[model samples]
Target: MLTEVKERLHSLGISVSSEPSNVDEVIIKFSIEKVTNHIKNQTNLSEIPTGLKEIAIDMVVGEYLFSKKSMGLLNIDSLDFGLIEKQVQDGDTNVTFAVEASSTPEAQFNAFIQYLRHDEVDFIRYRVLIW
Candidate 1:
């Protein structure tokens, strides 16, 4: 999952670097200046795939960054648009996406995968197709 995110972000021209400098202590780091800038620039996260407006709200993104229990985002109930629910069970966080009726599945999935590719949601797995 992390690998896919890394690839996606990289392909999108977003810089994501990692460090596993030590053999005994392994710590992977995903650094992105654009993300910070996006937040600092006060860019609104829209619900549309690949659209700035689709990105989660700044506050929510910050909360996810602070939330340590993120498991994955989306599920069978995640097919819909407009309403994306967050759940944490047994210290695991999962994101359930509910796209609006107007949103296309591809657009939703693209936006979602991009978000999951971000440094915040570490582990992600989804089967239900949005498109």
Candidate 2:
């Protein structure tokens, strides 16, 4: 399951990584504009996707974290949504998150973190593609 999520993320140009530790850290980051451009380049529509551009970042990220938890992906007790980080660089919006309070084993927790950290962001593409 983790491997499949990683493959899907790679297909969508998101990257996931972490440092090995007692409390492992998983970093998920992606470019919002890159995704927008990817959609633009793939489709014939000339209008920008307002849904994507106006998306509520917190809502999306929170729901995504909960969805993965409900799917048995991890034993995340709570997500530090308040501490989530976002930035803009080179005309692209980048969002990043750090995994915390997961009860799964360190390695397993890291894998689960990697899974959602990537899958949830890439899921945005599907949302826009089908919109």
Candidate 3:
């Protein structure tokens, strides 16, 4: 999965070093300023695939630390969106989504990074929606 993320980033001319601690997180190190600059100068949020919003939001909320478990629950399997759910606490619509590692690691990882270089809107949208 790391290899694929690296490859995709490379294909887009983005560079970063990723280190995984435990099964749930990947720490990416690079100049986020540069990436954001590139995003601003280059891509458009509308270009991101339809289903990537939640995963992208998770990446932002996690602060560039990708959650393997949350991603596993969100990704499609065998052309299916698959099953996943979010739990919202009383008086708040903000949800806490959780999951264990499943069989769709690569798909989830790919989707998570699909819009990573686009813009900060994904993060902002998440914060606005949550609050």
Candidate 4:
């Protein structure tokens, strides 16, 4: 699972190199634990079901990315100030820098965090009622 997480991170453009420190490994492990716990708690199961292995992997990836973003370590190449249309002129020299919530980093981060938090719907099918 760690290897799969590392590969997923690499595929997402996040370089999890061993050099400098083993923090990346720690983060990956933490994410896995977190996702596993979430699954167990939500499903009332002692272990993750086989059907949810892929979902768990995805959640772990999301958690890892969330951690990286929180620590300011995630490099968002899509974030470009130049690409934002701050001003538009139509023979009037009108300059307006409108900041949309969907375009800001904070907004994006919040949206992602919300996604990771409320993604239990995916695990509903595998839930076990223990009453």
Candidate 5:
């Protein structure tokens, strides 16, 4: 599964490192732009998308003037799934979440974080052809 994800990411222009022998503590590498573009590509967009993938990419970007955290740019980090698309063409993309204390809300946030931080996503494992 991990191998397929890496290969797909590669096909999308995201470079991935070999799987670490240690699953409990592993590092997965990827590019923000590549991941963002992959997500955008999975949905319908106005353009063919040859550049900065989305406007939302700016929000989560890590703040580092020198290092310059490019939010949309995917980097190797612990998998967090709660980060929602906030916007998607194919999907409604109409969901806004907030900081909640309830178990369900927390669960949702946890999932979002997991997805956002995920090293490998199953849906993005398909190969694409460019003509």
Candidate 6:
């Protein structure tokens, strides 16, 4: 799972180096566990289902980004999440980024949390209802 998350991060242009530092590994592991646990809890299952693996990977990536941002270690511009810019005018060098970028960190994290919750809807089919 760690490898998959790193690969996903790399694919997103986040630039996780070939040899990550101990701290980096810890952060990645933490993010994976956090996301996996959330999914497991949501579905009322002890393990993540194969069908939700991709979603879990994406969520882990988001969680990792959020952790880095909160620690002031990440530059939003460095990410290629497609949520960065709304428009860019090269002629006059006018650039407009998504509204969330201009907001407070808490607000941005809230928006991120909302996005993660949106993904949780996919777990509905796997949800276990125990009366």
TM-score of each: 0.20, 0.23, 0.24, 0.68, 0.21, 0.69
Report RMSD (Å) for each prediction in the order shown: 17.1, 14.1, 13.7, 6.9, 14.4, 5.8
The deviation in Å at residue 102 for candidate 2 is 7.2
Which candidate number maximizes TM-score?
6
- Candidate 4 root-mean-square deviation in Å: 6.9
Quantify all predictions' global Cα lDDT against the true fold: 0.37, 0.40, 0.41, 0.76, 0.37, 0.76
Cα lDDT over the full model 6: 0.76
Of models 4 and 5, which has the larger TM-score? 4
Candidate 5 CA-lDDT value: 0.37
**Is candidate 1 or 4 superior in TM-score?**
4
**Model 5 per-residue lDDT at 129:** 49
Candidate 4 ranges with C-alpha deviation above 4 Å: 19-21, 78-118
Error of 4 at 46 (Å): 1.6
Write one digit per residue (lDDT tens) for candidate 6, span 1-131. Answer: 99998898787667665565666677888888888888888888999999998888888888887787778887765444545456789998987765543565455555764574356679999999766
lDDT of 1 by residue, 30-92 (tens): 223334344433433222223332232332332332222243422313345435443334556
Query: Residue 114, candidate 2: how far off, in angstroms?
Result: 8.2
Error of 2 at 82 (Å): 11
What is candidate 2's lDDT per residue for 36-123, written digit by digit as tens?
4544554434544555433323222333344445557644444323333333345565543434455344444355445433433533
Clashing pairs in 3: none
Error of 2 at 97 (Å): 19
Residues 10-124, model 4: lDDT tens digits: 7655678765458878888889999899899999999999988877877898888788888988777554344446568889688766556456766655565566445778788
Model 5 regions lying over 4 Å from their true place: 1-31, 37-108, 114-131
lDDT of 3 by residue, 1-131 (tens): 34544554455344444436532234433323333333333334433344453443333333343333344532223333344343557785576654545536455545545544345554443232211
Model 5, span 1-131: residue lDDT tens: 23444444454344544647632113232234444555457533433243332222321121111022233333434333455333345475555444454435335534544444434233343434455
